[model samples]
Target: MASTILVTGGTGTLGRHVVPLLRGAGCSVRVLSRRERPDEDGVVYVTGDLRENAGVAAAVAGCATVLHLAGGPKGDDEATAHLARAAAEAQVKHLVYISVIGADRVPLAWLRSKLAAERAVADSGVPWTTLRAAQFHDLTLAMVEKMAKLPVVPSPGGLRLQPVDAREVAERLVELTLGAPAGLVPDLAGPRVYDLAELSRGYLRARGKRRPLMPVRIPGKAGRAYRAGANLTLEGATLGERTWEDFLSERVA
Candidate 1:
């Protein structure tokens, strides 16, 4: 029988891609979802909420591996800790995690939460692998789309992003989940980097709309961190194939 792998956040953006690939690789997947869901082909759903530490042990039971992907703006550390504790108790063989590139250096509250989540997985007794990736194209697109709604979009100076394809990130994650536990593999980023202004301009062009961009400075230490490119990984990182332009073309109407 194929080993059953547990996937948290299996219905999310990256999870949507990872779960299918895992299934294709002949692994029976058990997804932990907050809402109750019926079983599907080669995959089963276990109702659970990592945040509240509810239904976690049952979800981790009998699984050879646990892919920790459930995350939010906050409480990521707590949620991941909850899952880690359950996995440790279950003696799950492999624990895999997905994190952002600047989790440690960004100086943002949310990034701190992500960094803490990474620590939670590392401290878990189960063997683990964590992959830090750049901002997803989908997320970047949403930001730009929302900004374009205003009469004048505020473009933060020195705010640059290497937006990666979520599918590519998913592919790498599945490879890590299946393979031996390798701690902190190389970071993944997009082929090209674009500033906030450039990204917003691209979005406007794609939508056949125009908006004046107002150059704005990000205030406080967070701004300083961003100005220093703390959120970027320019070297020793695995670059994804899809560019921001490629994603915009396909996603933007």
Candidate 2:
């Protein structure tokens, strides 16, 4: 593998950890961001946007591997499609994309965008690998905080999640990026699954706050999908070692 790697979202939650690991593994890293950042040791910064072909081309050019991670529900599909075309032209050796578990099965708009991005990478004519991960522990905590703001904590009934650590996901992404493209790898999830109410209670326990949780059914197809556990993978999936409680412990410390 060549020593240079391009990570599209190096400033993101997972990318912050991934960039350092890549450098420690003896690879020079380049980060693409709209905002200018000072270049650090063993890392380079490139100012670019994924939406424009010119920006995408500059970032994709002269890289051994491209890590497509920066995206939102509105632009992920088109942005990834543009990246695929640029990467193919550059003949990038490996293109690794991060997606969410149940992206294909879930009926949410964000998941739908992710599924389209995955397909774009597959059809790009470039060597590629896509790994789907469960929700991050940080994301779970954020949701808990949001719900806690209500006078009465409202929890979605029958909603379950397996929130893995972002650091673990970053490590797995780096491992897959360095190796040969394996197409779609097994999904990664946390060690255990917890209901939304239980997770919120765990957060409350960590924060030393007491609140009553009111279970309610979420309306629409998205809600139905989540209630069916569409956002989780429990069959022969790779399990992350860090538990949500462990994450809270770290936060408290």
Candidate 3:
């Protein structure tokens, strides 16, 4: 019998790629969504919301592993806690969590929520692995587009980022699911770091547009931490093969 794995947020950005990869690896995948899709090869769509304990429990029943990737913009901590509790009740053999790189050091509210979620998973008493990855390259491009529409792109000055590929991050998570559930693993990053404005410029250039880039100095602990490079991966991390330039080319071409 193939090992059953339940992937929360299985229709999401990363999940779309992950679902196919796990299926190719011969794992029976059950995706938790708000609505079910028709049966497909190696895939089962289960409808449920992570915010509901009963729903989460039902979705996770009889699964050998659970990949907790469903997170909200602000209430992720609460939602993740509920999922962790449900995973514990279901006696899941392994729980794999996808988190951000600066979750521990950054002072952003979203990052704080992710940290709380990580803690909840650690305390859930299930064998688990938490994989922290740098900002996704797609996220960076989205940011650029949003900022470019504004009068100016407001960002902390002197901030650096190691934007990683979402596909690479998904690959690492799949690898973790097939292996022993270790504790926190090394952060995953891109091959190089780039400044925010430079990255923004790269995005504009890719689309054959030019926009005035203005770097703003944000106040508070979050701004200071960003300027201090708190989001960068230190040592013992995996570097992705695709560079920001390569990512832009792939998208534009």
Per-model TM against the reference: 0.99, 0.97, 0.95
Q: Poorest 10 consecutive residues of model 3 by lDDT?
A: 147-156
Where does candidate 2 have its weakest 10-residue lDDT segment? 51-60
Per residue, candidate 1 scores C-alpha lDDT tens digits across 67-126 of: 998889999999999999999999999999999999999899999999999999999988
Q: Per-residue lDDT of 1-253 in model 3, one digit per residue for the tens?
A: 9879999988888898899999999899999888768868868888777666547788888998999877778877887888888889889999999999999999999999999999999999889999999988888888878887776656558789898998999999999999999989999999989998888888778888767767678688987898888888867788999999999999864
- Residue range 110-205, candidate 2, lDDT tens digits: 889999999999999999999999999988988998998887899889899999999999999999999999999999999999999999999889
lDDT of 3 at 184: 98
User: Against the unseen true structure, what C-alpha lDDT does each candidate score?
Assistant: 0.95, 0.90, 0.87
User: Candidate 1 — which residues are off by over 4 angstroms?
Assistant: none
Instruction: Flag regions of model 2 displaced more than 4 Å.
Output: none
Q: Supply the TM-score for candidate 1.
A: 0.99
